[model samples]
Target: MPSQSLAYAVLFGHVAFIVVGALMTVLSQNLVRALVGLIMTLFGVAGLFFLMSAPFIGLMQILIYVGAVSILIFFAIMLTQSWSSGDEAQGPSRKRAVLASLTALAPALFLGLTIIFKSPPSLLVAEETEVSALGRFLLEPYILPFELISLLLTVAMAGAVILGFERRKQR
Candidate 1:
């Protein structure tokens, strides 16, 4: 078993990543910077999952969010003509920024309060969930939501392709 100090250090690091990344995600003017921040946030979440003894979830967090989703966002931004390197300096209006800040803070505050006030649940032992069990759960009982998400991604990709082609044709 790891020492208490070491575990605390790791937890602190993960929380730092989560807080900084989340701030960057919402605060950055640049879209790519925001995307990078989002990836950082996801990476932090993966770290937390690993700490909780959920390696499968951590792997999925890194693979799906940091890898695929980030790449997709990068590609989408690259393919767009509206957003360029120069435009990164230009930020949204003050009203919009305040609203966005409030939007992000509200949920975070609620979560913090909930954690503070809630009593711990009683359990005999913390069960370790296997990746195979998760796979079965996704494919069996939650198949509809899973399939719907896949379909949504497919449609988004198709739309992006069509939009890219149209933009190229016009240029």
Candidate 2:
């Protein structure tokens, strides 16, 4: 087992990456940059899964999220029209910014307070889940939902392509 301090350090690093990545994803004006941030966030989550002793979930996170979704987002960004550079003057007004921040922070604050106030759940022995078991579950029972999600992504991509061409035709 790793030292306690080392474990804490890993936790801190994962949390920091998640926070920074989430901020970049929400705050960046550039679509490509946001996609990069999303990839970073996904990687951080994968690390968290690994830390929690769920290697199968961690690998799936990297494979499905960072690999497939991020690549698809990057391709979509590349295929879409480019936007002007982000400028301070072009940003949202202070009032709107404040409102948006509050909108995002409120639920987070509530959740944080709830967690802090609530009694900790009873500890249970962790069960080991194998990747093969998970694969069978996904393929057998959840196959329809899984395939639907893929179909949804495909439709979204097609819509994006149509919109991109429409913009070109308008110009």
Candidate 3:
């Protein structure tokens, strides 16, 4: 077990990773760079899950979000070729930057105010949950939804590929 201060430091670092990655994702003009930032944010979230003693969730986050989703997005971006031509000529608009900053800050501000006003003890307390129970519940009761979501993702990927091919044909 780590010391309390050390744990706090690690938590802060993870939070910083999430913040910086989010900014990078939102602000970057390049699709590939934004995807990389998304990966970084996902990794930071996984780290936080591990720090909270949810190794299963952490691993799932890495496997699903970082490995699968990010790769899929990267592939789609590559296929679409949207990042290659006109992106460099146009810089980010000042209005978009201001809007993005405000959008990002709103949730943080709300959370901060909630933390300051609410009871910390209540916020800290969480119900003890077994990983096996969670797994069983998802596998048993939500299996249909799970399969449907997978199918949906597959369809979406196919659609993206088709769109990419169509765009290429048009050109």
Candidate 4:
């Protein structure tokens, strides 16, 4: 258990950053600022992971998320054809988009709140230390899902390559 003072600081600080980061992600006009906000959001999520007693997950989130996803987003920006001046207004979306997003968000928020309030506190399952344990599970029990994830990664990489090549070829 954490010291009361320490826990309070961590929890409140994490929550504050999460809210501010979410606002930054949504409300920033500049794309780069939005990306920075996304990075902050990821960092705040990683902090929450640590608070939940999974330091390993927190480290992995920082390493895989901030390290890879942020760079990928920047690369995607550079690979695009449009380089507009910052002065142009990002006009509001059409009515259909507004309606569609709200339609999705309303149920999502409701379900999220319900789950948060209804769930029992979680207990930590014991950790197994043997490397062979994972191998046995992965190859025997979880083979289908494992291969599915691999296949998805392959398709995603191929799509990224095709799009990237097309952008450069047209330029």
Assess each prediction's global lDDT (C-alpha) against the native: 0.84, 0.82, 0.84, 0.78
**Which stretches in model 1 have alpha-carbon errors above 4 Å?**
81-86, 122-126, 139-171
Query: How would you order the candidates by lDDT, starting with the best?
Result: 1, 3, 2, 4
Cand. 3 TM to true fold: 0.71
Judged by lDDT relative to the true structure, which candidate is superior, 2 or 3? Answer: 3
Worst 10 residues of 1 by lDDT: 80-89
Worst 10 residues of 3 by lDDT: 119-128
Tens digits of lDDT, candidate 4, 16-39 = 998898788766766677778899
In each prediction, how many residue pairs overlap at the backbone (N, C-alpha, C within less than 3 A)?
Answer: 0, 0, 0, 0
Model 1 lDDT tens row, 10-48: 999999999999989877878788888898899999999
* Winner by TM-score between candidate 4 and candidate 3: 4
Question: Looking at candidate 1, what is the lDDT of residue 165?
Answer: 83
Across residues 1-171, which tens digit of lDDT does each residue of candidate 3 receive?
368778789899999999999988877878788888999999999999988777889999999998888988988788778683644437877898799889979998999899888945553323546889988988999999989999998999899788768744454
**Residue pairs whose backbone atoms clash in candidate 1:** none
lDDT of 2 by residue, 1-171 (tens): 468778888989999999999998878777677777888899999999888878888999999998898887777666565433524226667899899989989999999899888958853334678889988998999999999999998999999888768744454
Off by over 4 Å in 4: 81-88, 91-105, 122-140, 167-171
